[model samples]
Target chain A: MKQILAVDDSMSMRMLLRASLTAAGFKVEEAEDGRAALEWLDNNSPTLVITDINMPRLDGFGLIAELRARDRFRDIPVLVLTTESSPEKKARAREAGATGWIVKPFDPEKLAAAVRRVTH
Target chain B: MLSALATEPRTRRHTIMQGESEVSSDQRMVLSTVLGSCIACCLFDPTLALGGMNHFLLPTPPEGRGEDRGEAERYGIYAMEVLVNAMLTRGASRATMRAHLYGGANLHEGMRAIGSKNAQFARDFLAADRIQLVREDTGGVLARRLELQPASGRVRCRHVAEHVPDGRPAAPPPSSGHVELF
Candidate 1:
């Protein structure tokens, strides 16, 4: 099974992600913030990193920058799952090495399709 | 801010109905709305003097309910995203954005707590996006009337008592009734 790391501060959102991804046949690891995500990444390598943009401490942008800076994590695809869909935000995510952008209230089927596309 | 604007005549006023959003860079425009078991988010970027407001009926579309993309703005997820994007179109940046939340009253005692859920969604959305939430007035059993000056980031919220079947105003529960500053 493909492994994924989902980072978000909202418990409800995390639960939704877990339920949706697990049902989609992927094993998902969870983190509350970008800092926690980094801590998790230190010991584990997931096929993909899905993150929320705004969070306490380190945010998704910082996390992406950190991932891009390190050789080991640099190749892993990062998907931004956020409520923001502005052109500026999207460009910034791409500049920071994001593989894709998915807006919030994502449909489970669409999200699964996105994951499969990136992982494959 | 509300008090300071009391005497200044608002040049334009727009009413934001439920499931609608409006953004403006004009300092003269003020957005107003009324809420019950709903939420209104006021977002402003002081640097650009641009802002927007959204009134959503629910936190997210009902799971597995076949919500289409066109009507997604009725939910918090799309409402907030659309509002932010609208502000950005007017040259506002997220880094300098500040937010204020209002409404979310559980007026119906025995029914589902939709109001609290909406309020929680707003809080989570703001936190997840790293927007600075400077003011919030949510929960309780009374509806609210809100006025927001998007460009100036000024807000005024008034808690209105719920009306009973007999048409008399219902007394507020002891735990509620505090005013939120702009």
Candidate 2:
């Protein structure tokens, strides 16, 4: 089974996503921020990462930067899931090695499609 | 239904109507309140159970809103930032101060998708910076009352549905479980 990492501070968000992903046959791991995501990464490697941009300890941009710095993680597909729609942030994310962007209150169908494309 | 279900009576209870947030101490209990249409983000330091709630009307002000309308305070971004900052000033860390956001019930009544929009805004704002919403009662054509024990982070949700709009859920808190009241 393909594993997916969902990094966000909201418990509900993780639950919501997990419900959808599980139904689609994907295993999901939850993280609250970039720092936490990093910690989770140290022990496990997920096939895909869906992270939010504004987190307490380490925001998405910072997380991507950290990911890109490591050769081992450089190739992992990262999907930015957030409410921030600024062009500047979007460009920054693309530059930081993000695979794509997914807005919140996400359409599970669309999200599943995105994840499927990147993971496979 | 509210009077009946809530008839059991809370030793102390607060009713935050839609588009309002308040901080108050009554008798021996200090209560902060609000109602959804807007979201009421309740910030509490569980160790201290000390916190405040902000009822932001729009994700941003409704475009042409007046400058002095305190419009700045009625935004999810500002509300989250301010409440967290306030709690921090009182010696709370961003990590420790858990957020309990209420409202954004997609009361899609009449012409306004206000509740849905608010819900999306709340999710985006908090998700941007990984803040977990512990408890939530959103969506439906119901008006909800949120009571937070800032000291313990124990919260109660009372649904008040008399007449309203149609919409989806606007709650952003991580779902632990939920008691559905229709």
Candidate 3:
């Protein structure tokens, strides 16, 4: 089974992501922020990373940049799921190397479809 | 703003923040939000007496700006879709749907014209979907406080800014706080 690292500061959002992804037939690992996500990456390799932009320790942009800079995690696709819909923020994420962006309050089907698209 | 309407036994006022939405079938339910550059789209279906409102921060997602589709769903599109879907799930029909748009004020100087873009996007979306736009108050230099009674399809918009950038006093709200739908 493919594993996905879901990172966010909100416990509720994390739980929702876990439930949705698990229901979609993927194993899910979680982190409270980008820093913890990095720590998890030290010991595990997820097929993809889904993250929120505003987080403590490290934000989504920093996480994507860090991952892109590292040879080990360079190939993993990163999807940003955030409430911020500003064009500036989207461009920043793209510049930082995010594979895709999904706004919050995501549909389970669309989320699953996006995950499947990126993972495949 | 909603407290005044709470006198009714079944009336519930809900304040939605940015990137959020609410749908209700109760005739007394009132939805409210504060807006600057963000927009609030209130959609109502008179046939079912059902309605919903959504607040979104931007006009489009990354793909709208020529980027790859890449799993993007911007708040403007997402909020509208979600609200409309919720209303439909509750038995509302598209043919009877009506739309009201508020906000899209350019609250700051020398900034990107996000407010106008957001307002235009809402207009285009409603037009494309063949939804009737009954009313609109958009594109100014001040923020606003908006309230909508979904089932009645009545809306009240009040300027929240104390003064305009040109130093003129802001316009006063309607003497009557509410607009009754006949």
Per-residue lDDT of model 3, residues B24-137, tens digit only: 877878888888877888888888777788887776544334122322233576566556656755676556888888888988786459889999988877775556888888
- Candidate 3, residue B44: lDDT: 84
lDDT of 2 by residue, A1-120 (tens): 999999876565566678779888999999877899999899898999988777667889999999989887999999987655556877888888898876443555667878888888
How do these models rank on TM-score, best leading?
1, 3, 2
- Residues B1-182 of candidate 1 have per-residue lDDT tens digits of 22213425747998887657789878789888888878999998888777788888888767665235444556776577667656755666657888888888888877358889999989988887677888889988888888888778788888888542111112221211111111
Which ranges in model 3 have alpha carbons more than 4 Å from their true place?
Answer: A1-120, B1-10, B62-74, B163-182
Output the lDDT of residue B149, model 2.
Answer: 55
**What would the per-residue lDDT of candidate 2 be over residues B1-182, giving only the tens digit for each residue?**
01111222345654443333444322234344445476777766655556666677677544444222234345554455545544654566666656666677655557258777777777676666555666556665666766665544556667776643322222332311111111
Interface RMSD of each: 15.9, 15.5, 18.9
Candidate 2 residues lying further than 4 Å off, grouped into runs, are B1-182
In model 3, the Cα lDDT at residue B54 comes to 83
- Indicate whether candidate 1 or candidate 3 has the larger TM-score: 1
What are the lDDT figures for the candidates, one per model? Answer: 0.77, 0.64, 0.74
TM-score between model 3 and native: 0.51
* Position B66, candidate 2: lDDT: 20
Model 1 misplaced stretches (Cα beyond 4 Å) = A9-12, A53-62, A86-92, B1-7, B17-27, B42-52, B77-101, B105-144, B151-153, B158-182
